[model samples]
Target: MGYLYIFGTILFTVYGQLILKWRIEKYGSLPPLVKDKILFLLQLLVDPLILSGFLSAFVASIFWMGAMTKFDISYAYPFMSLSFVLVFILSVFLFQEPVTLYKVIGLSFIVVGIMITSQSV
Candidate 1:
């Protein structure tokens, strides 16, 4: 059940990020940071999709806090790295992004590291 909370954290985090990216892509590029940055940020806040993304992130934090009560941070934090693996695979499919050899190798290392860390617990 603790693991479930961790996975929920990962899932919502990924969903929030992807939704933000999708909304940004669809809405056009952001104004330059130096050019009316505050207004640009305000505009982003009112966007429904971006608001949903923020909500997802908020929910992820809630799940993460719940997970923290169930296990040591050392035991749980490494599992968060699984989000990178998931996001990478998902980005390729959802965004038509290219998958490269190095990406595969790097993701494999993440999996290996998680396995090694799990052994200590």
Candidate 2:
């Protein structure tokens, strides 16, 4: 059950990121960093998809808090990296993004590191 919470945290985090990326891309480029940044952020606030992504991030935090109650941060924090691996795979499938060899190698390392760290618990 504790592990499940960790997985929920990862999934929600990844989903939030992916949705934000997709919606932002659909909306086109943001204003320059030095100009009207507050207005740019305000635009995102009114976007339904971006708003949902923010909600997902909130849920992910809740799941993260629940996981922390059950496991040490060392054990749980490594699992958060799984969201990177998940988002990479999902982007390739959903957005027809390229999957490079380096990405594959890096993702494998992340998985291996998580596995090795989990053994300490």
Candidate 3:
């Protein structure tokens, strides 16, 4: 059950991150230092794609938090790092983004990290 939670968290978290990336591509970044409510509202309303992405991401976050509560951070957090690999794969097909050798190497590292962390737990 703990493992299930961990996997679920990783899945949702990756999906959420991909959604966020899509949102960013659709709408410009919102700087933390900025305090303009009017501009924020305009951005929110003007970009439907960004809005959908935001909504999906918000839903995924709830699942992620629940998973965190059910598992150890040291074990679960490392597993979540696999999301980097997942997101890379997702972006390649979903968004037609380029995948390079460096990304493949990074994904290999993530897999190795997951294996090591699982053994530790």
Candidate 4:
């Protein structure tokens, strides 16, 4: 059940990130002027998809709080790094983002770190 809470946090985190990126891409880049940029962001704020993204973040935080009660921070925080690995792979496929060797190496390290830390549990 504790692991489930952590998993929920990871899923919500990933969903929030991906949804925001997808929606923002559709909205295009920020405007050049400061006022225009403010207006542009305000436009996104009302978007249902963007709102959902924000909600997902809130949900993720709740899940993280639950996780906090279930395990030591040292034992659980490493799992959060999995979000980075997931987002990296996901962005490559969903956004056609490039996968550099350095990124692959970094992700490998994250996975290894998680594996090592999970042993403490």
Among these predicted structures, which one has the highest TM-score? 4
The candidate maximizing lDDT is 4
Q: What is the C-alpha RMSD of each candidate to the true structure, in Å?
A: 1.6, 1.7, 4.0, 1.1
Clashing residue pair totals per candidate (backbone < 3 A): 0, 0, 0, 0
lDDT accuracy of residue 74 in candidate 1:
91
TM-score pick, better of 3 and 4 = 4
Question: How do the residues 3-117 of candidate 3 rate in per-residue lDDT, one tens digit apiece?
Answer: 6766666676676667667766665657565566568657765676656656656665666677678877776788778778888889999899998898898899889988988
Tell me the TM-score of each prediction against the true structure. Answer: 0.91, 0.90, 0.69, 0.96
**Per-residue lDDT tens digits of candidate 2, residues 1-121?**
9988998899889999999989888867777875677787788889998999999999999999999999999879998999989999999998899999999999999999989998954
In model 4, which regions exceed 4 Å deviation? none
Q: Give the clashing residue pairs of candidate 1, or none.
A: none
> CA lDDT of 71 in candidate 1?
88
Instruction: Pull out the clashing pairs in model 4.
Output: none
Q: Give candidate 1's TM-score.
A: 0.91
26-96 in candidate 1: lDDT tens per residue? 76766787667778777888999999999999999999999999989998999999989988988899998
lDDT of each: 0.90, 0.90, 0.73, 0.96
